[model samples]
Target: MVRYLILRTLIFVGCLALTWLLGLRDREEQLLAVVIAAVASLVISAVVLKPFRQQASADIAERVDRRVERKREKAARSDEAVEDAELRRPAGDVDEGGSDSDFR
Candidate 1:
């Protein structure tokens, strides 16, 4: 894990260094681009890889337990998602028929 982070950070810095060495006379934008790319990569890695890493640390049995718990919670809440009462309310009040009152 430590090595992976180091390697990724090194790559990010390397890009910045290379751009500078290659004489990007307008390096302000070039460096900013690298910073943006690095931040985006970090955000994506955090969202995607971080969760998977936690799962990887656990034994198979533990992982399965966590997974089954998640599934059960998801299944329990499944009905409420479609049962949002406001949306299910009658549309009679909405007047989608486009009568004369629409122009008024």
Candidate 2:
């Protein structure tokens, strides 16, 4: 991801520099030059950086899958702990009277 970002940034800077070198910076419509440069860079990057973008996306998806799996495992462990605790409780500890003092 970082490499892709750096590559994209470099492409944009290169386009911007090229536009500036072509006397766009001194033109009265300087914003037009910036816009043109941005569009050009975006198009070029979309084509040239396709593989990098795909790789980054795949990496992100893998990370998300791992996170979800971890969460599921943690939840399963928590449920097991609760069940174990209930199983370990004495049968005589039942609140037959349903009184608040049982908690105390």
Candidate 3:
């Protein structure tokens, strides 16, 4: 991701420099120059940075998958613990009171 950002920045700067060199240095032309540079950089990066983009995407996906797996494992462990506690409770114990919501 860092590499992709750096490369994309370089491409934008290069395009901006090229536009300035082509006579867009004046204040009035600077905006146009920036717009053109941005568009050109976007197009260039989309084509040239495909691999980097893919790698970054894969990295993000892997991170998300790992996080989800960790959450799933945690939930499974919690459920197992609850089940175990339930099994250890006295079978003769019964709730004869009102619903818990009544306390609230």
Q: Pick the candidate with the highest TM-score.
A: 3
- Residue 52 alpha-carbon offset, candidate 3, angstroms: 0.3
Cα lDDT tens digits, model 2, 6-93, are: 9999998898889888888766868878898889999999999999999999999999999999999999999999999879877777
Clash pairs of candidate 1? none
Across 1-104, the per-residue lDDT of candidate 1 in tens digits comes to 45456655665676556656666648367766677657756665676566555555555568789999999999878867667764766656454565433355
Residues 1-104 of candidate 3 have per-residue lDDT tens digits of 99999999999999999999999999899999999999999999999999999999999999999999999999999999999987986775555663333254
Q: Which of the predicted structures, 2 or 3, would earn the higher TM-score when compared with the native?
A: 3
Candidate 3 at residue 68, lDDT?
100
Instruction: Give TM per candidate.
Output: 0.31, 0.86, 0.88
Order of models, best TM-score first:
3, 2, 1
**Candidate 2 global CA lDDT score:** 0.90
lDDT of 1 at 53: 52
Best by lDDT: 3
Q: Positional deviation of 80 in candidate 2, in angstroms?
A: 0.3
Q: What is the number of backbone collisions in each predicted candidate, taken in the order shown?
A: 0, 0, 0
